[model samples]
Structures are given as structure tokens and as C-alpha cells.
Target chain A: MSDLASKSVTPGRDASASAATGYRPSRTLPIVAEIRRQASRRRTQLALGFMVLLPLIILVAFEFGGGNGDDDSNGGGAFSSLVDLATSGGLNFALFCLAVSAGFLLVVVFALFAGDTVASEASWGSLRYLLAIPVPRARLLAVKLVVALGYAFLALFLLAGTGLLVGTLRYGWHPLGSTIAAQIPPGQGVLRLLGILAYLAVILLVVAGLAFLLSVLTDAALGAVGGAVLLWILSSILDQITALGSIRNALPTHYSDAWMGLLSTPVQTEDLAKGAISAIIYAVIFWGVAFFRFTRKDITS
Target chain B: MYKRQLQIVVATSDQAFLTPAAPATYTVAIDGQLTLPTLVGTPIASPAAIYWYVLGALLAVVLLGLAVLLLVRRARRRRRVTAVNAELAETPLVVTGLRKAYKDGFVAVEEIGFTVERGQVVGLLGPNGAGKTTTLRVLMGLTTPTAGEIHVFGHRLVPGAQILSRVGALVEGPGFLPHLTGHQNLEAYWRATGRPWEDARFDEALEIAGLGSSVHRRTKNYSHGMRQRLAIAQAMLGLPELLVLDEPTDGLDPPQIAEMRRVLQRYATDGRAVLVSSHLLAEVEQTCTHAVVVNKGRIVASGPVGDIVGESPSVTIDVTDVPAATEILTGLGVRSVTPDGATGLIVDMNGTPRAELVASLVRAGVGVDRVVPRRRLEDAFLALVGDNSRGSGDR
Candidate 1:
């Protein structure tokens, strides 16, 4: 390799010579690798901590407030109210945890996961290098989106699962009481809990999509996540306006609390179902905007 | 229609409130007649609301499908790390009539064309904002070209083109996670490619970087030069077929710069090509075999370093009699002569050879201490581009 001309880059420049560079460089950025990269971030740790601590914090607050332990409150909110059903069994307690945090805390969590993934890469000046590495630009975004959604789901599960564990240990695994439409069977409680959490996860897609869109729009990670959270806050404020009529239903945040219907004795899934649908709609639109903008973006940052 | 009568109906998940055994049935009190919308079917049972939802869902699915198809097509085109391949045996990079115009209506590069042949260390020579970066960006498929074409190894360059796998570039500067060790950063990068660790050729790149044990230390703790070296090593990974480096010697000490010079020379061997961008004509002079000089978004001149420097010939003479030397050199049909300090005069010989200048100087009784031809690519560069130094930053 001493001579600049006579020798060249070595064994051989032909494809037959160096046969292995991992299938090809045109491959997508591996999802597993992206997940690994993001899983170790400080914000990720902080988000997980908030998820785990939220349940215990609520439980301790319930104990101190003496929560009227009148015991009848253990019944569901007749499947209509959005208050804590913590007095119910472990399952309802988890639902209570989700209900309290869904509007804001969970929105922030989803935004953090989705918002920071791509924008942070741009901020770090690594996006160009990633593309230079020949990670097809589209593939890079796709993998980042997948990893972001995965993290969002993981955060939701952690909060819900932790609530279940702590609630079960503190309260008993009793059936949902009469506050619900009727007393739900103890055996169906776990299934109901999982269903409610799943719906909550679906409702969060709006936040995820909005954050991901902002992530594409800006190079600042804080701006992307903060913007998404701020958007949700505004939507929540708008939901309070009865003057908006059914028009308000078009709001992505409109169905945020629809999951409460899942706890009804017989379960009224209409509101929750509408909310899930709305989330998907918003997620698809926002994600579409993101992909469109990203592909056309010059990527100077 | 003027005065709407309100009615309420209660229903649960399964049973309506009509069932006496039902413990609950939530009510939706409609002050008016209920309504539903339909998408395409007959407007039968409460179809108004359904219409809106169905429309929204359909809209989402269609857009999602479009986005997915575009992305899948891009991803499906397998990314090859072609830098390690020998596919471009003769032609490594080709930029034909390349032009780049920013969104601001500023045309950074205008129809610049050049080709980097294998085994040649080509230098992208320009002052700041000369469109050097923009040209390289077009070549590497970073910034899309407004017009013209780029073909790497005979394959047309597109965003994320598979042909790019054959290129290793350190554009802008080194961008690494501050908290991660140099080795970890490289590891993460290589792993992100999903390539086998054995093919990374990490040891060789590290050796070229001369990072030694510091590779194990976090990048935030490394010096600026160290980071730059790490970036070089990064670009060198897998021993790319075409290495495009921007200011490869920037931030490097003289010894490291010399070492870099050697590394680039050796790296350019074996049919591999290296395209280095730099504003320093001196550095490019020693480090590159050919030079492409750009000025104000246009290529001013380009050719072998020897030819470019020869194009702007000059002579420097150290003499005891500055007045006499200046007088004799000025009389020798030279382009210009400026007294250099007290004892030397710089002469732009233009085309006159050293023997004629020596003979003329001896004939004039001007004691010539030393008559040496100045080998300055800068002189050639400035001669070609003129002295327009504004608006360009080494950034």
C-alpha cells in the first residue's frame, strides 16, 4: 500500500473479493440496534422512573387522604366518570393509574419517546453521517419510527404493569364493585385491565404521531417533544368548550378518556372505541406529514 | 325542526336498560333526533357519524399505504457497503454538470463537472462557500442536485443510492456521541449498518488514525484533533473504495498532518480513490495527485498538481544586491517582481525557465545567492480565481 497508484485499496475492489459487509449497506438501520442506542439515554431512564414512581405516589396519596375507604367506592364509576377507581381491585387500581396520567403525564412520555428519536440525531450532527454511511434516508426514518413506537409502548406498559403489581399487593384481586355498571367477575378483571391499557396505548398514538411530526420539522429535540405536549394541552383545553359541539369530537384528544368505558359492568366501548379510531386517524395523518417532509428535507443540520 | 324534543335511551355493553337484571345502562340524552352518516352504502341506521369516521379512516389508510410503499422501495434496495469493493476499477466518482441551488435562491454550485479516477488522490480545492461542500454533497448524495448528474462506479447517484456503499465520507466534521467512547461510537455506527464485526477492519482504521489506547476513552474527553482522527478512522472503516474526506488534516498537529499525508498516499494505492476537500493549497499540494479548483460555484481550473502549479510559475532569488537583483529580474521579461523583505525578490517568471533566469542574473553581475523555482499551488489557485477572498469561511 506504499505506492499511491500501483497498489489500490487492497485485496481486490471487486465484489467477489470482499464478499461480506453484512448482506449489503443498503439495508435498513437495524431496529434492534436503534432500540439499543435509545434505551440507554438519560431521558429514557427518567421516563421509566416517572412511570414506576407514579403508581406508588398515587397509592401513598390515597393512603394519606384516607380515600374514604367507605368501600362502596370500590365499585366502578358506573363506567361514566374519569375519577380514580383505585378503591376497586388491583385491576381497577391500575386503570385508575392510567386514567389519572393519560391526559398529560402519558402524553409527555409518548412525546419524549417519539419526539427525541430523530431530532436528537440531527442535533448531534449524526444524521448526515448516518446517511453518509448509506443508511438509505427513508430506511433511517422508518427504523427510527419503529424504535420510537416501541419505546412508547414500553413506557405505557411499564406504567400500567407497575400499577398492577403494586395495586395487587396493596389491594386485593377482588372483582370490580357496583360503581361500574355491575359487579364484574373476578376472573375477567385481568382481561379488562389489559384491554383498558391497550386502549390507552392506542389513544396515545396521537401524541406519538404529533411528536414524531415535530421531530421531523425541527432539529431541536426539546422543541419537538415540548411542542407535542403543548399541542395536547391545547387540545385538552379545547375539549372543555361545549360551544364547539360535536366538532370537538374531531379533536385527537377528544377520546383520551374513552378507555373508562372499558371498566363498565357490561362495558360501554363506544367512547373508548371512538377515541381509538380518532387516535389512529391522527397518527396516520401526522406520520404521513412527517414522512413527506423528511424525504424532501435538505438535511443541512 | 324549531323546537326539538329531547329523549334519552340507556344501554350497556350487552343489555339495554330494559333488562330488569341489568345493574347498569349508561344514557346518551339526545336533545334532538339521532343521526349517523354513511360513506358509500344506504344511509340506513345512524350513518352520519359513521360517514365521517369511515372517511377519516380511508384517508389515513391511503396515505399510510403511499408512505409505506415509498419507504419500502427505498429500504428494499439493499444498501451495499461497496466502499470495500473493487467495482470502480477505473472510474471511482463522476460528477457531470452538477448544480446545487439552495431554497433561498442561492446557487451554491453551478454546473461543476469533474471525475475522480481510481488511484488518484483528488483534492476539492476552494475557499469557503466556493461550493466545495455542496459539490461533495451532491457526489455523496447528501444534498440533491438542482441539475446534472452524479454517477458513482457508473451507477447514477440518488439519495441513498446503493452505489454509495462503496464510498466512505467524513463530511462537515466528526459527529460522535459525546458520552460514548471512541470505540463505542464506531462500534455503534458499524453495528447500525448491521454488518459483521469481522468486516469492519477496525484495527487498520485505528492504526491509520493512530488513536492508540485513546480509542477506549469517551470522545468528550478527547481533544479536538483526537476527535478528528477518530472521524478519519471512522471514514476509513472497512477500507472504503472511495474515501471522501473534508479537511482531513484540519485540527491535526504538524506531525499528525505529515502522518495523514502518508496515510492518504498509501490509502490511495491499490486502485482506491481519495477525494479530500481543503482550502489549504499547500496541504492539497502534497496530499493530492490532482486538484479541482473551484471559485464562486464554478470550477476555475483542474488538472494534475504539477500542471496547475506549472501554469503559474514563479521564481524566488536570495541575493546580496536586492536593488540589482530586482532590476535584472524585472528586465528578464518576467510578469512581475516584488522585493521580498531586504535580501530577496520574488519573480513571477510566467514561462521563462530557470537556466535563462540564472544566465541573465549572472550577466547583470547581480550576485545570486540562491535561485529556486517556487512550487506553490496557492500561486496557481490565486492566479486562476483572482483575489476574491470575501464571503468564504474555512468552516
Candidate 2:
């Protein structure tokens, strides 16, 4: 404590020094603190619960439908639908899981994790107090963005890791031969799977940033999450319309499925590269907007 | 389906393998529904043009980011300059010609300036739309000033300014997350400050809030009064040097209000200053040592509560024989004599002294039970704020 930390109503001696010395607030909210605040909430648990249950539900559905192996689409599983890839080894099945979930379910998961982070605080009327707690306005949003993205990436990892574990146990860990590059070593195979997982994580950062930006714009947590999901759905719809020309590429959903290129014989690297670069560019833009708007916002809530 | 298209290509390829010299001109139809824009004449877009478009978009976003960064930097620079230039000596707060014109062009506060020194319990009194809340908002750095300046703890008050650590504020009303327990809300709030939890006088604040075991329960179950107390406790964390409360007693019962009054008095005892805004005039009069009266975005009167409510000509007299006193007072040529009831009357003594009225009453054998000045805070506030400055209130 400083000498000026007195109870007298009059300004303390060396008042400026006392005031300056006493209140050196940290620039960021601790990751642990943020996790505590987020983990205790119902939405976080609900999202996790849904994520854990998804693999089991898909497993049941596949068990009921696995008898239909008489279909002729078997060899095309690498570049084709997940339904064709189901009977493959654990690696292919997990990849199939990522393929299916990356469309909307994982988008919802990203929206829930990152999108609900900041806006929920604002909706609950805690944002004003956080800023008033002497957390610099920019720092408040920055801390939230970090924690939100952290959770988002963690959720993706968990989903994929869970699928990997369950698929390995249910099936056998055979080499992913067709798409695994001709006669590749076992270590390289694991590396390729990790590489694809990493690629997906990077591209999904665009959604994380988008949801976070929406979180800053709207006070309602559900609105932010739903709005991001809506935009993703809109992008997917637009992507389907070949008439959109290159304009559909501007939509956030455009590059979402670009990870499929990793399954090609020679590994079509162009689409994967474009997707990663575009995602990074879009993510940077979204986060930029978030920081700018949040710092200047009136925060009436 | 693309699969059907591929199957035709495959069958033709198999036949070509069987007959090496066979000539085949296969008609293959690709999926037409693509966004790449190459199926028809006058193609405006293509997959080849995508990289350029993405680059152009990235450039636009980068430029926007730069612009916003420059603006934020300029604001920060200006705040630093103001803080350095400020001379906030011997006062916890000082406002010099502060003005705030909201984006909607509502001049909520205009050139309203005052100093809150130590050991002062200053009441900010105003009617609806008189700008009391706006003034506090500006002072707390929650809103920016348009053309004036504010210094708290001898540093410029601006958004993200660190001097805010020395001051605690509960503006408008108590806002808390209902899902969190009162204690949890306070805990989260303190942690958000980035200050160590040890610096938080949690026990002291809890005692002040008087939530007791309810502090452990969620604030969602709290009554309006409990919420207010919790807010007060949140503001009191670390026992900040300056406390700015808006309508602190608004939701409190009489007993709670009384306890809050004592808490405020004790808060200011050790040289800490408090600025409280209240609509309740009697409460302000009873609780505050000094007052600043505002009306229509301007300060009308400010000084000690006693000075603002100084002796007025009107006096409420309680007497044993009201009619007899009224008759005598009417004959004595008082300005106006309105009978309050059977026991007393309110007399507007137009320059007549209370001593003279008492002597006259005694001469006439009317027993005067009590005599008190009618200098009420309500009257003082209404008089200071004026008659026509009411209504069209802003929310």
C-alpha cells in the first residue's frame, strides 16, 4: 500500500503517484478465470454434451445402415460421400466424421463457443462492470477473443480425437491405403491425419473470428451464435449456386470443405492452400472489426 | 449425378483398352450449377479471378483496420496529453466546463462543473431530465466529454484511463448477472479488474452489503433491495478512494435506506469522498453534507446543504389555538396565512421576524407550542430547478 492510501476525503499527498501506483490492472483476463466463468454456464456444458453424444448417435445410425454394403460406390470413398467411406479403417472413419460435422454441426459448435463468449456477458449486464473494473476496453474484448478461440479449437480437437478413439476401438487401425499416398510409412500416415486435422482447425478459425465479431456486435448470446450459423448456412447455399461466379468465394462458408483435397491421389494442394489463406485473411478481418467496434462501443447494457 | 457422368467415361475407357484402335468421341456433361460463372456468354466471373477478388477484399479490410487503429491511437494520445496538462491538486475530482452532446444531439450535460473534495458527502440533486446521471457518467469516464474536461484523483477521466481504479461507480442502477451468486458476481468483477483478490476488501464489503448468507445465493433470487445492496458492495470493493453512486437508496426500504445512510457517512469519514445522486430530497437533506443542484443541463445552486436550504420567509407554526393565532397573525399583516389544520398554520412572514410574531402571540395569550422554518429540501430543489423545466424526460 502507498502512503496516499488513506481514508481522508482530501486528496492524498503525492496523490497522482498514489493513484498510479495502487491500480496497475492486468492487461488480460487470466485464461483460468475466463474458463471458470465459461465452464460454469449451462450453454458450455450443453454444447460439450451434444458434441460427445454426436459420435455415439452416428455410430448407432451406421450400425443400422452398415448392412447396405451392396452399394457400388465403395472405391470412390476417398473423394466421395462419408457414407461410402464408413467401412474403411479408423482413420478414414474419423475423417468421415470431420467431413460430416464440419458442414453445420461443428459450425454450430464454433458459434456456441466463440459467439456466445462476449455477447453473453453484455446481455447479462456484466460487460459494463468488466470494463469499469479497470479492464481496458480493448483488453476486455481481446481477452474474450483469446479465450473464445481457445475453447473453439479445443472443442474441434476433442470431437476429432473422440472420433479417432471410438473408430479405432470399433474397427481396426489399418493403414488408410487408397488416400494415404502409395506405400507410405506408418509414422507418415499418422502425420497426414494430424496434418488434415490441423488444416481443418486453421480454416475453422474463420468461423471462430466471425462468431466472435458477431458476439461483440450483439448483446444477446443466442443472437450472436444464431447469426453466425445463419451466415454459414447462407454461404453454403450461395456456394451451391454455380451462377454466383467467383462471388460465392467471398462467403465465409466457401472454403469450409476444402479439406477434402487432402484425400486425393496426388493431394490437390491448391484448394487446401487457397482455403487456409482465405480463412486466415477473413479471420484477421473479423477480429479487427471486433476489436475496433468493441473499444468504441457505448456499452449501454 | 457426377457419378453417372463418370461411369459413362469409365465404360468407354474400358472398351478403348480392349480395342486399341477404336475411335470414340464421348459427350460428357459436367455439373452446370456452379458459382464460378463460366457456363454462358459474357462471363463476368471465373475461378481464375478468385485470387484477385480475395486480394482486393483483404486490402479493403486491412485499410479499414488501419483507419480504426489510427483513430484509437489518436484518442489515446489525446487522453495522455489531457492527463499531463490537468492540475488536479488537493481534490479527488474536478470538472471544468464539462459538456456532453450525445449522438442524438441531446445535450444531457452542459458546462456543468464542480469539485468533490475529501470528507464531503455531496448530494447531486435534480428533477427528471436535469442531467444528474449524465454528469456522473461523464465524470466516471463511461461517456466522453464533447468540449470540457474532468479529472479524477488528479488524472484526466477518459475511457480506459487507469485513474478509474481509484474510483468506484454504480451508474444508472445496479446491474449484475442474476445467475451468479452475489459473492460470485463480486468475485468475477474483481477478477476482471486484474487486480489481486487480496486487494479486494471482500469481507468489509460483504458486511456493508449486509446480504449475509444470501450473498452465497444467486442474485436472481434477490429482491430489488438486495440487488441494490450487492451493487453497492461491488462498488465498495477495495474501498476505493471515491464512490459515485446513482440513486443509491432508490430501491431500499426505510430501514435499508437508513443503514445505507450510515454506511455512506462512515465511508466518507476517513477522507474518502462520495457523490450520490438522488430524487428523494428529504433523504439528500438528511444524508448529504453538501449539494449540487442541476436543472436543464446546468448547475443552479451548489454549496453546503444548510446554505441551499437557508432560512426562508415561510414558517410552519404549531400552536395550541390555531384560529386565535391565525386571527392575530392576519391582523399583524403577514404576507399570507394558510391554516394547515386545526392545530397550526403556515405563515409567510413578509419581512416580519419570528420574535415579533411570538411576542404578539404571547401578548394575545395564545400559547406557541413550537415554531419551525419551512425551508424544505423539496421547495429548495423546485425553486432552484424552476417551475417550467419539467417533462419530456429522457430515459
Stretches of candidate 2 off by over 4 Å are: A1-14, A18-22, A25-28, A64-66, A69-80, A177-186, B1-82, B85-87, B316-348, B354-372, B384-395
Q: Score chain B of each candidate by TM-score.
A: 0.72, 0.73
RMSD of 2: 8.7
DockQ of all models, two decimals each: 0.32, 0.26
What's the CA RMSD for each of the models? 10.3, 8.7
Interface RMSD of each: 6.4, 5.8
Candidate 1 regions exceeding 4 Å error are A1-21, A64-85, A178-180, B1-89, B310-312, B316-332, B335-347, B350-376, B384-395
Candidate achieving the largest DockQ: 1
Q: Report lDDT (Cα) of residue B103, candidate 2.
A: 86
Docking class of 1: acceptable
Compose the digit string of candidate 2's lDDT tens values, residues A175-230: 55443345333456566677788888877777788889999999888988898888
